[model samples]
Target: MKTEFTDIAVIGGGPAGLAAALEAKRAGVKRVVVLERDVELGGILRQCIHDGFGIHRFKKRMSGNEYAQAFIDETEKSDIKAYADTTALELTADRKIYACNSRDGMLEIRAGAVIMTTGCRERTASQALIYGERPAGALTAGAVQRYINIDGYLPGKRAVVLGSGDIGLIMARRMTLEGIEVEGVYEVMSSPGGLTRNIVQCLDDYGIPLHLSATVTKIEGRDRVRAVTVAKTDGSRRPIAGTERVVECDLLVLAVGLIPENELLIKAGAEIDPRTKGAVLNDRFETSLSGIFAAGNAAAVFDLVDYVSVSGEIAARGAVEFLRENTSDKNTENASGGADGYVPVIAGENINFVIPQRVRKGAARDLAFFMRVKTSAPRAELRCLCDGAVAEKKVCRYIAPPEMLSMTPCCAAEREIKIDAVNE
Candidate 1:
């Protein structure tokens, strides 16, 4: 086994990993390294050829590949070492990584700090619980995307998208452009899962119908998908009786949802939050296991790629600070009278979950809090309470479960914090 060392070791060279590596270098962290499972740096973005990305980050509309390339170019020009086609098989809570590549057989990398940007994986057909024999035509929206965009092969002539996620909406448009008939998009929830822009450009402009509160209950055909039975869902999201309709199509694309790929972190004895399905993090993106950080989709699924990059930068900054401090003391008390120099954050009212579930006491820098609401509201107020006193508040014209909310209120010293989204 080969042994190596780095100041920071970033796992998964996707958008988050690349951005983290670059920011670590910018933060004066020497010997930053990135390990990528794919042969190239770009992750899923490589296959996403559609535009509408980078509108916030670069101030211009760009394709997924173009957005990834901007950071890849910067990474290539720097001294940061990136190992492509390398997979991190094991990660320890103490910042040790066991990885393997074609050139480096069975290697061990000891890093001062570790950043996990492993990204998220799509929910498969079996997980969606559609009663049917496994058919060849049944695949995830990502598979359909790779088949058409990367391999230049249309998977089917007629398709039924089972979810209204951003990927499903985009694929609906892509399949239609490629001469494939997209029958319709069915979402189980009352509201669309994707952004409003996607609903307009992908479905509205393309004349594709979006069936809300509907879901595919069954799949038919042994060899290939011949049709599917879609039914209206009630308030509980269960298929309603007497509302089943058969839609004939060769393909069934499942865009149900995504789960963070944090198996490595979980196995390494890190505390996980059931709400986000990620790690319990602080304002600096530092996990409960000190020196280990998680960002981007691995932390929680953000609505935009710009947010993913920003998360990576935040984790990188946290990693750099950890290295400078040379200690794993998250409990170091500040001069302010705080409980162990940390403030526990709570999600109240309409809020579903909030990142940075805790705040380090007396940190001078402002911290951005990202959260999602449990329900939709026309007029709402995002309220922040410190020890039951109103610390900050912001108003919103509209808020929904699908849209994530971000706030960078004035930083506060350690006090029990609670976030609430109240309907006006």
Candidate 2:
């Protein structure tokens, strides 16, 4: 194995990784390296051709490819070394990365700080529990997107989407534009899973029907998908006994949800957050393992790419600070709850989850928390409580599970803090 050393090593070269690497370089990290598993730097954005991106970051509506390309171009001009088609096989908690690529055989990279931006993966048919024969036409929403946008071929003439998430909604519109007939989009939840604009542009404007409180129960086909049984569900999401109906379609696209690709984090013995299914991060995006940070979908499945990039920069800044301070995981872990230690950030009523599950008491700057609500409320108030006292509060006209809220509240609690969203 070839051994190398760097100031920082970043895994995954998607938007988050790119942003992290760039920020680290700007922060004066001399030897920064980025490892990408794909043949190119742009990650899933390469397959996303739609134009609803970069509105927050760039003040213009840009396509995914365009947004990613802007960062890619900047990285090319920087001194950072990026290895394409390189796969990181193992990541140790002590800051060792075992990776391999075609050009560089088996390689070992020792980094002072490591950032994970491995992103997230879509839930497929088997994971979604749509039973039947595994057919060729059954694929995830991402697969269909690549097949049409990149490979230039339609999977089928007619399709049935099993989820109402953003990807499913976008694919419905994409397929319609590609001359494919979209039967409908089904969701077990009563409310739409995607943003309201997506529903307006992708489904409603395109004459596509969205079936709420319904899901595909079974698939029927021998070699290719021919039909699926969809049924209405009760409040608990259990299918109603008499609400089953068969919908005929050659393709079934499952966009049920996304899971962060954090197997390496788990293997490295880093603390995991059950709510976000990522890492137990502090305000700096630093994981419990110290020197190791997580960003983007690898941290949590963010609704916007702009937030993903912002997370990368935050993690990079944390990594830079860790390098400058020359701290170890032992020192960091032992300091929790001390005068300058971290405090627990809890999720209260009507709140699904919050990023940066904890925060340092003496943090220099305000921390922006990204969170989703448990249910929809027309008039709601988001609050931050420290030691049972309301420290910060924001009133919202409307709040919903599908819409992720970003708040930068004053949180300098000594022991614990709670985030709550309640109907007004």
Candidate 3:
């Protein structure tokens, strides 16, 4: 029943929470507390020891644990408070957190600003609607990773992966290295669902087969995963009846996708964008609830961890500024991300969705556009039209519904108009 107060309270201690706490402390916020549910600060990166990360920001390759450790060391020198084994159970619109820690039990905390970096959760078998009998052999790719690498147990001897995303691809190769046989990965789309590098290194290099435009139409197995029914599909994603084939396997891993963890944010009266499944925020990263900021996977899924760290820093700065200005008087005042003030309208063309639908008019300031193309486009021109002018265009070689599209904005303030485009 104890209570505490701080200038900033950061939820979750992954890269995002770490970066946010460090940045806020550096910004002259004296009281900052970081709450993480795990015994350690690092989140999903702890079990991931692969070396494909940090190629962009570090300019060199580093393991996931290595990147996480670097951030830990950096935070050690700062005044940010780290609370491991602490879970935030509830968040209030007024930046109040109701949390519980193993050592301290239940506690109430109020902060001038709150930053949510709860991160995302891996999709489970239920999310895919795979009609397989409940079996221990079937598990999420992330779960299998923790069991083998962290918990030290083999998931299975022979496996068939249901998705071709990064996790599934990496596990497909990893299982092979662990003396397990990976039959192949089945992707529902024509193009692979993961990074191109993964498709090459994890599957192509290892000679693991990948079947595109295919899916698990029927799942077979009684007690455990003895086999599965894989089938090819047509353009409409309907399984071609005669193309079904049964493959023998002891395990089936689903690595379909990750969704943002925003339950607490939503319960706290935050306005969530149905598009991103995350909160809709202003330029400052502050949600409709003033003084509450969100970043990292909890806000929206990112392509790289480097961007996750950067977004964390920005959210912390936003939280600190919100406290400094004490803008309760101007709470209703809205800020524009750009100068020209742009509207967002989608053309009824081959475009799935777009992020930050409303682009504020002004100079471009490193805005990241997250989207998904309507269909597979090969050697097509992807253009963004703003107010009847060609604002941006890119030579798109391929686009898939499974893969996310990230485009950077580069325009003057006059680019504040509705976005309409078509694939040529």
Candidate 4:
């Protein structure tokens, strides 16, 4: 196989990968390459034509496609190399990436440091367990977005969206504008999984029927999705027998959840985080493999694309620092291992998953953490206790499973924070 080497290799062409490559180049990494599988550089954003993306990061409201274009346009003003219509089929335990393209057919690329920003995949109807016919009209919400926005085809005349995820809610409003009827949105949880602003603007303002504490139990159809059966749920989320009803529709879009794509990182022998289902990295975002770094969705499921972009830039900075320091002597293990240093894995009452399982107490490294809550927290104080001392503390507006909370170290130390709760 033909092989080449670069300063850095970014695995995705989405916002995260784009931002990472851009930052790497800006940080003076002369040879930066981004391998994207799609013909376009925008990734899924090209199909997400709906407006609402870019609020915090860009400080301006823009559509997903528009934001994607903005990033593409900016890259043109820089020296980032983007390989469109390319795929990395295999990755070795080291940093060797086996990739293929139309022109090259098959090839390999080695880099001094690798950055994983492969993004995520949407959960489908089958995963949702909504008993349904295998029909043409059953599509994931992201697929529906692609059909309408990119393929120039409307999915259906009438629809019923399952799950109150951000994508599902956005589609509810988009369908209305396209003159399609949205029967209802069924969510198993009492509260929505999307941002609070989305629930207000997309559902409440549009008079869209949002059935909380309920879910679509089954779907009925022959060749196309014709109708769906929904049932009310109690606190336990078990369906109430008599609350079932058949709602007619031509399309069923699933927006249940998104799983991070971490195949490459996992293949590189990186420690995986059980909660995030991504690579386990330290404060600087360097994975168990010293030369291999990760950011964006490959690190965790981020709420907004802006956060993904921010994560990519940070990861790029670390990659640049690694090159400048000329530190390439250590193995992927001792250079990055910290799992044994944790005294004990502690989870505060009501706290969700705490990442970093452990931190090295010495060598003076920055400690960062990712966490969420078991349930909705009106107002909970997030505190970390290490060695019977309050190592770090921060107040949270609300903590829920849908949101991933990140905290950087207040002081430079590899101390593990024993997470716990405090009064509002």
Misplaced by over 4 Å in model 2 are: 327-340, 388-391
The digit string of per-residue lDDT tens for model 2 on 1-424 reads: 8999999999999999999999999998899999999999988899989998898999999999999999999999999899999999999989999999988899999999999999999998888877888878899999999999999999998999989989999999999999999999999989888888999999999999999999999988999988999999999998999989999999999999999999999999989998899999988898889789999999999978999999999899988988877755555432344325877889887989999898887533567788999989899999988768887899999998877787887656777888999899
Clashes of each: 0, 0, 7, 0
Give the candidate order by descending TM-score: 2, 1, 4, 3
What's the TM-score of each model vs. the native? 0.94, 0.94, 0.86, 0.90
- Candidate 2, residue 414: the lDDT equals 71
3 or 4, greater by lDDT: 4
In TM-score terms, candidate 1 sits at 0.94
lDDT per prediction?
0.89, 0.90, 0.78, 0.79
Where does candidate 1 stray beyond 4 Å?
327-341
Candidate of highest lDDT: 2
Which residue pairs clash within candidate 4? none
How would you encode candidate 3's per-residue C-alpha lDDT over 331-383 as one tens digit per residue? 32234433234444353366666554454455555455556666665556666
lDDT (Cα) of model 4: 0.79
Better-scoring candidate (TM-score), 1 or 3: 1
- RMSD of candidates 1 onward, in order: 2.5, 2.5, 3.8, 2.8
Regions more than 4 Å wrong, model 3? 327-424
